[model samples]
Target chain A: MKSVKAFAPATVANVSCGFDILGFAIDAMGDYVEVFRKEEPGLKVISIEDDGGKLPWEVEKNTCAVAIQAMLDDYGQEIGMDIALKKGLPLGSGMGSSAASAVAALVAANRLLGDPYERKDLLPFAIVAEKAACGAGHADNVAPSLLGGFVLIRDYHPLDVIKLHVPDSLYCTLLHPHFQLNTSDSRSVLRDAIPLKHSTIQSGNVAGFVSGLYQEDYELISRSMRDVIAEPYRAVLIPGFYEVREALKAAGALGMGISGSGPTLFALSKGAEKSKEIAKAAEEIYQNIGLGVDVYYSAINTRGAYVLEENK
Target chain B: MKSVKAFAPATVANVSCGFDILGFAIDAMGDYVEVFRKEEPGLKVISIEDDGGKLPWEVEKNTCAVAIQAMLDDYGQEIGMDIALKKGLPLGSGMGSSAASAVAALVAANRLLGDPYERKDLLPFAIVAEKAACGAGHADNVAPSLLGGFVLIRDYHPLDVIKLHVPDSLYCTLLHPHFQLNTSDSRSVLRDAIPLKHSTIQSGNVAGFVSGLYQEDYELISRSMRDVIAEPYRAVLIPGFYEVREALKAAGALGMGISGSGPTLFALSKGAEKSKEIAKAAEEIYQNIGLGVDVYYSAINTRGAYVLEENK
Candidate 1:
């Protein structure tokens, strides 16, 4: 595989209570990229499309370019690569749009370089690239884009990453309100202090969700995913957040919460049919609020990052 | 199988960062009780001993009696039984003294009642009984005593419980300094509100520990068991806590933290040699503080509440 093309799917971080540490991939929505090895000695940005004149093309500001540069820097081989990114997921949409691009570029670059780097080795580079784009080093988006399934960013220092088995019965319905919420702005709006009791409650939910994944207890997992700290405060910024969640719950959705930084809300359900119902209900709720909405029904992607296609 | 007597070991709650949600059993360091059916219309507290007259004999004030009564009240059965308490772990030692009595009595009673109820079925009863003793309904202790191993009490409502596999290479060393830190008093000292940044850090540690347990990464588990929110503030009351933890860590102990509330400190290690070293170092630290100390080395108890000896 001298040169290859890959698609890294967009992801939902925070999965309710698991902020900064937990994430899952969405298969249908993602970014596509292509890479080709060059005899020259430096990573070169070939082209970018569908960014709506928003993303930067510079090596420092471009997520794909930064990721490839980091990988080349780590490998100590100044092998050059021509990369192209077609951004499919919307930018700054709380849907891991940048992470998908960074992951896809790094994965394609790693393949172009005779597979010199392991997939896990690419996480930090992707995180760094994401940091350059979002101005924060959060693994919740990058981990899922890189490793698939439900990835737990155990510790960022030594980078302890664990792939969790998502239950087959679990399905997600994402409602993107067609609004942008910058991760930095959302983070800044959050309170600098939280009640200790609220923190304890959130921790309990996180533990329960992780354990529920292990036990395949959907009921427990849903009950445990409630977030009292970040979501309660962040939801204030997202229109129809509470109404959508309550409507979905009333419509038999198991659990619901803001996906990552907000403006994008997700509901967890027991099956595809229920997930569809949830999506329909969420779209209606958003429409009632006079906002455009894009809804996707997806299952937990077990495969993390992978090469979708290759060219000779 | 006509009659049975069982002993449920005591537990240490709040296992560091896992406040109100995590606990583990201590081997041979708990209350012992026996239960046998009698041909009577109501439950009876037959006898109590070795409790230093600290506990009440009235059924309402007795932890064991109240627990059994809750079960009886729920079932509305005319079953009667005799309960004997052999208090081995001292009261008010931050060692879950009340949880032990509740668990042992419930286990014995359940067995005497032909074991009709599942262990989880008895959790709410035990928690309610615990509230009668401690004035709060918390499961950090009761869950471990009932389930064994390291337990994460994810939620009280609908009961989200996750039991992580305890690694065999791990040894628990508990050092109880001669002092009393009432759970309520210790709880009162805590600031009702905490800085949100600190809570986020603590939540990260919780996520790291849970992920570590799932991956069976012992080093990460030890590194991630840190408690920044509660430990610093609470450790001030426990004399020499800082010195003991420092010495143990210096002597190659994996990690150390206040066992439950305070006064009793615990450490985790891989080898028996290191566990002994930690215990010895802790003893020296406590001695330097002019406090009496008792140390115990044990592994995670997989068998939670069980019958110890049956009277044929």
Candidate 2:
């Protein structure tokens, strides 16, 4: 195929208690990328469709460019491609915006290259692209966006990934505050070291949270939802964070926390009715603090990145 | 009922990846305690029938005394009781020796009191007794001993416990080195602070480990079987821990790790035949180092602590 188009769904990483290891895809918004073959033997960014916004146009600085370049190097192929990006998610809103672009581009490029590798085989390339957008090469966001459903990055050295289970009754409500907190600054606010006691508690929560998901126990999930490592320090970056969490809880959210890194807050519930209440409560709290927020309610996204169209 | 007798099983804590949070009961051996009610309003240790070894006869210093005392205080009863103890496991062997005694005593006392509460209602008293032994209150040892099977203590403040699933085919092989390491001394060897990077990696392992148990994925469990927090520091205290671990791995054991702190090393296999081979390999390694060791084999204990006899 000479041209291909793909869509990559947005993913929510960290999942309250699981810090850097857990993530799940959300269906509200995502990014779309198109790749077209060219005679010029290099990757190029044709356009970035946004609302009068400017991003790095240089191929070396863009997420999709770096990821595709890495994949080409590994496959030992030199092919020219022009890429276009359409941002359906707000940049730096903590909804895995960067990861969506990187994943969508890789999926598109793979199709344009005649599908040399399987879908799961493209994670390494996607992760390298994520590193270009953020400083660290974390797969929590990318894996779910690429593979769909709930996913766990068990280890990073060899890039191990495990697809996790999520119940059908579970629903999510995300409130994105109309402000920006980029990935680098969001990560910088966290402490490098933590007490052993805190880590133990965090580990306990991680175990309980994952076990709860498998058992379809909502109460267990609510009780296990906690973050002592980064949430305490990063709470100050988002305005009205504490009050919003309290409101979310008061509205009967099974669990709630910062959705990726900040600017976006998410609460989970066992049903759609409670999910709507959680979103309304959070939005009202943000409005009371003189801030406008965009709310998105969704069931867990089962489909991840996918090829939209291909032409030979 | 004027008298009640109960037996509490031995518990293996930590389970490699989850420190201070995960544990499971073993069927090989346990502690037996009997409580006889009297008209006099005081709790006392009347007899400790062991291998001619004397324990503290005083109530304040003993874990069984502290646990039963707490239970009595909560019940608002000052009934006098004569308590007899029988130790089936060695002390400081990392088999949760002290926890077995405490859990047995609590179960016996509750039975004698006409079953004032359910099985799980006794965790607080059991945990208070564990504090007397470890100097810090933890339920990883006591919960599994009291509730049976695999249990996860998600939080300590409110005492949240979640029972995890264990595959029916999984069996345990433990080699207790002929040495002792006190809980406090084992804890003292560990550092108070950990880098966030290590904790994140550890969290991944914890998530994977629990998920593996529920899915019956032995390969995932083995891959996630790692201890970055306590094992490295405490291994120095055990004489041939590294060589024994290597031997366990060489013998095709699914996973091998410290039983709680040190000295006792446990390996897991899918069935009894492979379990015996794992035990043999570990024992052979310790014998080559000129050290004598005690070995035990068991399937995961489904029944935790139980009333042996209820004399009404």
Candidate 3:
């Protein structure tokens, strides 16, 4: 194919008890990337759209360009490629915007190279792009975006990413308040040392949550979706955080927690209707705080990144 | 029935990554308790056997007697009961010996009182018995001993115990070297606070381990069977721990870890043959150290405590 266009879903990481380990993909919003093969021996970003002029225009700084470059370096190909990125997810919203961009680009580039690598094999390249984007090659977001569905990053040294079972009727609600919590600032609010008691509780919840998924027990999932390590400290950075959580809980969300860091929150429920209701409740809370909110409801996405279009 | 005799299986707690929360019952060694209804309105310990005469004979301090008393107190029964205890498991062997005694006693007393409470309802009584015996009501041992199979003690305050899926072919090998590490001394060696980095790794292993159990993926189970928090410090308490772990791994054991405290070690393998081999390897390691060791091999026990006999 002369050209390829791909889509990668957004993801919710630090999923309550699964901080730094668990994440899931959402079907509501994502990023799209189109890569064009060129005869000229160079790589460049031809255009970027819907980024509100905040994303970098330079090729080395952009997630898509960096991801494609990583793929090209590993493939040892001197071929030229032009890239176009369209952002459906908001930047700095804890919706895995950068990861989606990088994953989408890698998906397109791999297809344009005549499928040199399988989908799961593209993770390292995506991690390289993540390192270029956020100073840490965290696979929590990138793995789900690339592999789809629920993912557990079992280990990092060798990059073990496991795809876990997702209940059929599970739905997610994302509420992004109109503000920004820098990832570094959000991380700085966390304690470097945690009590062993809290660690044990967190492990129990993690085990319970995973068990609930396999058993398809929604009540167990709700009871297990608690974040003792990060949410308590990060909640203080977001206005009306606890109130919004209570509102979501009252509105029938199974559980709610900070999606990635702050300024955006996510919840889970049994059906799309309950998810929508939760979104409405969260929107009202953000509205009461005099901040606009963007809400999206979706079932858990089982398909991660895919080729949207191809040209002969 | 005027008298009832019951048996409770032994258990291996901590199960690697699930320290303070996870355990599984084994079908090998256990404790037996026989409760006889009497005319007077008091509780008494009539006989004890196979306990090396070290076990307390007083009704107040004995585990079986204490457990039966807790059940009677909760049942609000003004009846006399004579308890006969027989120990199949060693004392201070890290094999849930005390828990087995308490569970066996509770099972017998429950049957003698016509079973007002279901089997699972006996957990709190078992915890009370544990508190009387060890000064803390830790449920990792008692939960599996009472509920059977694998269990997760998800919460302590409300005392939530969850039964987990145990792979049908899973077998256990227990190696008890000739020594005793006091539970309090083993606990005192652990750090009260752990770095957040270690906690995250621990949570990842716990989630992966549960997922592996449900999926029945033995390779994943082996990979996830790691204890970063407790094993590092506790390994020093047991001589030749690291070498024995390597031998178990080489002998095709899926994973190995300290049973509950120290001196006793447990390894999990897929089949009976592999479990026996692992046991042999562990035995050689302890024998070379000039210590006599006791080894038991059995499949995962699905039935916890049961009535072995009844008299009319």
Candidate with top DockQ is: 3
TM-score of each: 0.90, 0.95, 0.98
Provide all candidates' interface root-mean-square deviations. Answer: 1.8, 0.6, 0.5
lDDT of 2 by residue, A187-250 (tens): 8998889999999989999899999899999999998899999888788988988888888999
- What are the per-residue Cα lDDT tens digits for candidate 1 across B56-171? 87888889989999998887787877777888788877778888899989888887777789988898899989899988888888889888888988776667677876777767
Sliding window of 10 residues with minimal summed lDDT for model 3 chain B:
B153-162
Ranking by lDDT: 3, 2, 1
Question: Could you give candidate 3's per-residue lDDT for residues B1-312 as a string of tens digits?
Answer: 399999999999999999999999999889999999999988899999999999998989999888888888888878899999999999988899999999999999898888899999999989988999888899999999998999998888787788989898899999999887999989998999999999999999999899988999898899999999999999999988888899889999999999988669999999999999988887888888778898889999998989999997
Model 3 chain A lDDT-worst window of ten:
A280-289
What TM-score does structure 1 among the candidates reach? 0.90
Pairs in clash, predicted candidate 2: none
Least lDDT summed over 10 consecutive residues: which range in candidate 2 chain A? A49-58
Name the 10 consecutive residues with the lowest summed lDDT in model 1 chain A.
A153-162
Error of 2 at A21 (Å): 1.5
DockQ of 1: 0.57
C-alpha lDDT score of every prediction, in listed order: 0.82, 0.89, 0.91
Per-residue lDDT tens digits for candidate 2, residues B1-312, read: 389999999989998988989999999899999999988888899888762574677899778889999999999978899899999988878889889999999999998988897889999999889888778787989999999999999998888998998888889999998876777788899999999988998899999999989999988988999989999998888898888888988888888899998678889887888898898897789889999899988899988999999887
